[model samples]
Target: MTATPHLNTEHPKHNLTGFIIFLCSESVIFLAFFSGFALLKTAALNWLPPGVEGLEWRTPLLNTVVLISSSGTIWLAERCMSKGNLMGFRAFWLLTMALGAYFLYGQAVEWSGLQFGFTSGVFGGTFYLLTGFHGLHVATGVFLMGLMLVKSFIPQNYAGGEQGVQATSLFWHFVDVIWIILFVLLYVWQRS
Candidate 1:
């Protein structure tokens, strides 16, 4: 059997040391945003939007389940990739993408139903800022997952699927984790 070319090539799968550093920097940025949010949250005591009372948690909560389930599917996809089961990897990856789409759709519906727009007040602004950035990250995860699916089909990109899957999973998990904090801060902890 001819030896396959190095899958990671110049990327992190071949050398994750640098990838960890990149992840750390990303952590720093998000931490700063979270800190700013904490500071602003106190100022919301008087100005907090009452429209939040009308917010429906069911749909958003369901979306949270979608993300958590997608994380599971990603683990299976990684398993399939390790077994060199390309079709299995592709299928699970598609399921994960679909779940991600469902989560975004839920977000759109939730936002549409909100009485306050993004600029309505400090609450609206920060709410959008936190969730909007999270949505962007989810969008990026979808694209990255799609990239892995495409690469899975191309024999040339075969070796890198594992790396792609792991990186995508990392981003996905981070998105979920951030949302957990966001949910607590917005829905539970910060309640007046």
Candidate 2:
């Protein structure tokens, strides 16, 4: 008689739960910033303040488009992964990463040309606080996606374990949704 070893296949619910809790906490921080901005804007004589009139909507609009499109790519990647189409998954994931990088680059360019600092005034302070934090989240999402991409290349790493990809897709979509709200608040609402 031979003794056989058994594989442990316990499914832990901690990963998804932990991620949801993290998102909830992050949303609280963002809500605080939003409330502060609303209060400050309501009290200010002018929204953008002096020397900041050159803030054009075109660049931010373009970045928004890029970011939104990345959300779609991520969806496709997740679909491919679910279907076990590794090639399609990798291609869409890479495209998603490139779009995220492009969006971040556009943000850097726009920030460089701005005449305001984080402490410039209420307008600048709130603007930088919100957008900077959001940019950091986007960078984090991109970094996580890159890690997943690399893991996918290894046969033993991501084999039959695509939960990371789904988690990453959720995070990317969250970042995109946040940016859309911020864009409307910072650009469109500010103009009205």
Q: Lowest summed-lDDT stretch of 10 residues in model 2?
A: 1-10
lDDT of 2 by residue, 33-118 (tens): 88888888887787776766746799999999999999999999988988888899999999999999999999999999888899
| TM-scores for candidates 1 onward, in order | 0.86, 0.89
Q: lDDT of all the models against the reference?
A: 0.79, 0.87
Q: Report the number of the highest-TM-score candidate.
A: 2
Over 4 Å off, model 2: 1-12
Q: Candidate 1: where are CA atoms >4 Å away?
A: 1-15, 50-54
RMSD of each: 5.0, 4.6
Estimate, for each residue in 26-131, the C-alpha lDDT of model 1 and write its tens digit.
Answer: 8777788788888887655655676456456777778888888998998898888889888898889899999999999999988887888788777788778888
lDDT of 1: 0.79
Looking at candidate 2, what is the lDDT of residue 123? 82
